[model samples]
Target: MLILTHTLHLNRPSGKVPIEIRLYQPLPTGASWICNFEIDWPEVRLARHGVGEDALQALVIALQVIGAQIYTSPYHEDGSLRAYDREDGYGFPVPSNLRDLLIGVDKMSF
Candidate 1:
């Protein structure tokens, strides 16, 4: 069982929104593990972040990591979800066009 926890600070005009999570449910692939995810922590932030955009992308990228996928679990002890090979995620954020020059540049072509 591999659990991934993410923390973000949402600044809202009404008040400061705090403590959001991205939960990944682990799955078995062949003999190793894989993951799919759903959100379980805060409902309010979902209103602002809008599901299926930022949330799922973050979880997927985090798991298909280059060197490591094993991390600490953040779910409550009684959390009843289990991981599987396929991921059923909800609510992700649409991305902005702003590019980070430090990443994803094709150096050989340049």
Candidate 2:
């Protein structure tokens, strides 16, 4: 099992909110990599899972959900939720800075 830990900083209006993350990858031969992710915040304790060959992919998926929660949390500065228009006609709110942590790791192919 591959265990990874990270602390994410979300630049909120109030201040920089720190979130703790723990990711586990159990890569068994002949099977896809399954990742278990956990997030910790002052008022939120969340867990999620994803299956993918690359850890970054799983992290990305998990972050999407976590980001949504943070964006909509009462602690968020914007009283109203923010939305974005996509070319596919789907809309999504601005993601949290947790997603930004993957930028450097995303470029390298494992």
Candidate 3:
């Protein structure tokens, strides 16, 4: 089942590229939940999973992982980004500003 779908408009020197991020329902694995996600890029697609304590946590972790990938990847002169198929251990850290842009502010309060 699909949980959430978000579109991010990445600005490049050439123009803006719309990237679609989709989060799917997490499945239980032992004591953790594994969330599956897909990032639809211009010419390539990325499919990965994240493990967390619960469904929401799993989805958040998946997004964080994807954000890290985007932050670490090299950009072309035109400002277009590249994504690798394999994972890089302890990838580059995502800045707060980028995180806010990607995940947005949490409006919910206790």
Candidate 2 lDDT tens digits, 1-110: 44766665554568666767676764433555556777776676887776666656655655455555545565444332222122110122224453332222231311
- After TM-score superposition, the amount by which residue 69's alpha carbon in candidate 3 deviates from its true location, in angstroms, is 2.2
lDDT of 1 by residue, 44-85 (tens): 322111122344444454433311111112221222222321
The digit string of per-residue lDDT tens for model 3 on 32-63 reads 99999887867789899888999778867776
Model 3: which ten-residue window has the lowest total lDDT? 101-110
CA-lDDT, candidates in order: 0.31, 0.50, 0.61
Model 1 segments beyond 4 Å from truth?
Answer: 29-33, 39-60, 63-110
List clashing residue pairs in candidate 2.
none
Ranking by TM-score: 3, 2, 1
Residue-pair clashes per candidate, as listed? Answer: 10, 0, 0
When summed lDDT is taken over every stretch of 10 residues in candidate 2, the lowest stretch is 83-92
Clashes of 3: 0
The C-alpha local distance difference test score for the whole of candidate 2 amounts to 0.50
